[model samples]
Target: MNDYYGSVPLEEYEQILSNREYWDNISGEWEMCSKMEDKLVRLGTFVQRGGDLNRVIALYAGGREYTYRVTIQHCIERYLEALTNKRVDNLKLRLFKLEKEEAVKLLSEMLKVSIGVDFRYDKYTSRQVSFGVLDTRWLDAEGILTAIEQEHRQAHHDESVEEVRKRAHTWIGDSWW
Candidate 1:
């Protein structure tokens, strides 16, 4: 199994970029291992990451998919900044835009909070892990969210629909601009 993404220092990314096997070889290059669908099977496919001129990676390293995905969901932006050798919200750009450091202060401050969230669906346990923190959201895909209208789940939490909705509301609201 591979170690978690971001577990290594910045040098590793530079090394990966230099390797011929890991690239999609488009205009610039995309990391073949970073694509989500069919991963290594589509090593040269055009599935995207980064955002603009940037690209992506896809991998098929055995048993590492889960860790890579979870870490990606949390840290892709920062990871892209490193891989592309660009600051996510580059302070220099901000400084130039305003011709001073004052305009960049808030943007700089914004990067300080490092938080991550993941919702893992454990099919074996039939439990839905939400928020990467709370083991909540018992996960009713159908209309039977309540116990009164429920099926037998292998492993489910007893959180009420109202509570789950409230948590969902807070998370969504907090995420909004």
Candidate 2:
């Protein structure tokens, strides 16, 4: 056999994305939204660590898209839960499963209003082109680092759901909530 030690083909990435059994197997372990958030950080770090964006997009399109999409989705879910004191499963469903344009619109609206972050598709495309930090415009480098550190600390400590809800309210304030 010829030596073939290159990145996996894009077709393989598409196959993996389409494999229902593969996703089902992995989905069980991600019941907690925090786990998905952690994965997003790791993936962001991977891109930041000089990982080739085109290669990443080629080899793991689903992963790249999922990380970006799920991070925003989970954040929105947490914020909505804190605001309404009610879980927002339908919002999560829309964020996770809707068509790309619609989902991006919703995410952009939420990020803009909630965090003063501008969510732009062009920024995402530029990051892919340059292999820069994925969607870093939402938060500066320092802010991103702080957020990641806080997330890690929270993950290690088991806080009740209600406590997290309360903290979110304090974080955004009752006027916004």
Using TM-score, give the best candidate's number: 2
Task: Judge candidate 1 at residue 153 and give its lDDT.
Answer: 26
Candidate 2 residue runs with Cα over 4 Å from true position: 1-26, 32-34, 60-177
Q: Report the C-alpha displacement of residue 103, candidate 1, in angstroms.
A: 14
Taking the tens digit of each residue's C-alpha lDDT, what string does model 2 give over 24-59? 223443443334333333333332333332333233
Q: lDDT of each structure?
A: 0.28, 0.34
lDDT of 1 by residue, 33-81 (tens): 4542222212111111111111122232223434332332113233323
Window of ten residues with lowest summed lDDT in model 1 = 44-53
